[model samples]
Target: MQKLRRYLALGGLSVGMTVLAACGASPTATTGPAATTAATTAAATARPSTAPAASATIAPAGVTRTASASVTTPAATATRATTPAAATATRAGTVTSGTATRTGSPTALVTPSQAVSNLQRLDNSRQTWAFTGFTVAGLSGNLNPVFEYNGGNQKVTLAAGGTNLEAYQVGGVLYVRAPIGGVIQADASNPLAAPAQTLFATPAALLTALVPANTSYTVAGTETINGLQATRYTASVALTDLGFVNPALAGQGGTAATTVWVDTTQGVLVALQSNITAAGSNTAATARLDVTQIGQTPAIVVPR
Candidate 1:
């Protein structure tokens, strides 16, 4: 079996929008601009003072083996073994040849070290930018989210009035706090370490981290995602460890395969799809992010 080197990169982006409009009741009688102005003023004065109203929308969105053996001889055969020496040598040679055939050439099982080196080098010099936008799909809700990072440190800001939530890292610790109601607070904690920190902490940050770093992964095939051509790379990896669907997630166990799609020319990841099989069933989820607009630089707040 060939030794396969697989790296699973995960992340996603979402856009949402909310519009506010102020409408005035039809004039009770014919009115000119002056009359309208007076009516507006009167209405303003008549209306009771109130706080600003806010709304928010949110879209939240890869193995090998080896074997060895030992041999032992009985103590009773210590004196007269010369007769079987020739036969033993022949059998040993055959066994060695058979083992080689069964296990395959050493080169077949090992990836060129240069590939790993290239991947790391590319990752080191990678350039990443931040993005913030509003996304709306029909009428589910509006998502206004912000992300900040230089391919590593990330913070996410989500605000939808009562559903305001924030997640970020500080001193390598991940903290997520959200309001359950008008005044209730809830929080969840994680190790906030590498790999996990890189992928789950921020979607944009993870995108930069997952870009192939000169690590040559065999292309699985080509498929269309959201009407765009996407290339899929298969890496031998553990899905759980990669943070695709871990126990921390509600229904993540038994995830089998993960596929990522990137635009061949732009080198931007357009979509990510994962198929998970748990409890004798299969469930799949997909995340799609399109760069409708790009910003000069993302505004991120790093927690102390």
Candidate 2:
């Protein structure tokens, strides 16, 4: 917590300045909400596969929000654990299901609820998966966070500048380790948990919010991403549908071209990409999150 505090303190003034500059400058920035939201939600593959060009003119579909449980985070502190001084590489996940279940036909359209439900269900099933992505907005540097989940166990490694923090939630115990502060056990009630949660929750929650009941998307065939075959869906939605309340976008009109990949058989979310742009503007912001190594991560036993 101390190291994280110091890192935030050092960047606080710079962050503020960057925001002001972004608001005044032209909108040609590569950073925006899409990046930040996906950062909390997913990752990039070390060996990425390209999808066909995505379009926003797909016929809109009628959809409604479906309730899903929030991904649980540990609430109690536990004994100290070994602390690594730097970020570590995570292996891709394996499929917990013996045979992945494919969903929808090549011609079938997908609803936002269906897409989100598959993601939430995967989380609930205790199926192991991992993702790594970076969030950047305004002039702030990118924050790359890696997340891995296995049943009730979860781990996240967040780094910015040279400060790195690792957190693990195994069963009911939570442990946080930073390069400078060693390790401390904490729960959801700890104030320090707030920032970590903010960084972690954005991706998953934002993906849900971004694909509200009004989205229209179609399957674009199956592609292999990090060893998993996932059906890709593409859509274009108004910025409002994505929970963006920007007055400028509202008045000027904006849209997001989104593409997502879901496990063919298991329906788990495999990757997501969104490009947001206001009409009549040359500038656009894009965000992407990719999940790999479903069911294959090393066990997250109580950190030793």
Give the best candidate by TM-score: 2
Candidate 1 residue lDDT tens string, 1-304: 1223222111111111111112343333345777899989988866643312211111111001111111123333543476588789999999999778434332232232222232223311222222222111111133444444323444545554345555655445565543332211223333222322333434433333233343455566566655555555544222332233232344334333434554443344444433434444444333233322222234433433
TM-score of 1: 0.30
Residue 288, candidate 1: C-alpha displacement in angstroms: 5.3
Which residue pairs in candidate 1 have backbone atoms (N, alpha carbon, C) closer than 3 angstroms, thus clashing? Answer: 15-134, 15-135, 16-134, 16-135, 57-142, 57-143, 58-143, 62-237, 63-236, 119-213
| Candidate 2 structure quality by residue, lDDT tens digits, 1-304 | 9999999987997887688797885344446666866765554431232221122222122111111112221211111221221212121122322223223342133454575676665543222222222232211235556777778677777666666667777776677774455667777776556556554455566576556566777767778875777778888866633223222333455677878777666656667777777667764556667676666667776554
Clash count, one per candidate: 10, 17
Task: Report RMSD (Å) for each prediction in the order shown.
Answer: 54.8, 52.0
Model 2 poorest 10 in a row by lDDT: 61-70
State TM-scores per candidate: 0.30, 0.52
User: What is the lDDT for 256 in model 2?
Assistant: 71
Segments in model 2 whose C-alpha atoms lie over 4 Å from true places: 1-112, 123-139, 187-191, 241-254, 278-283
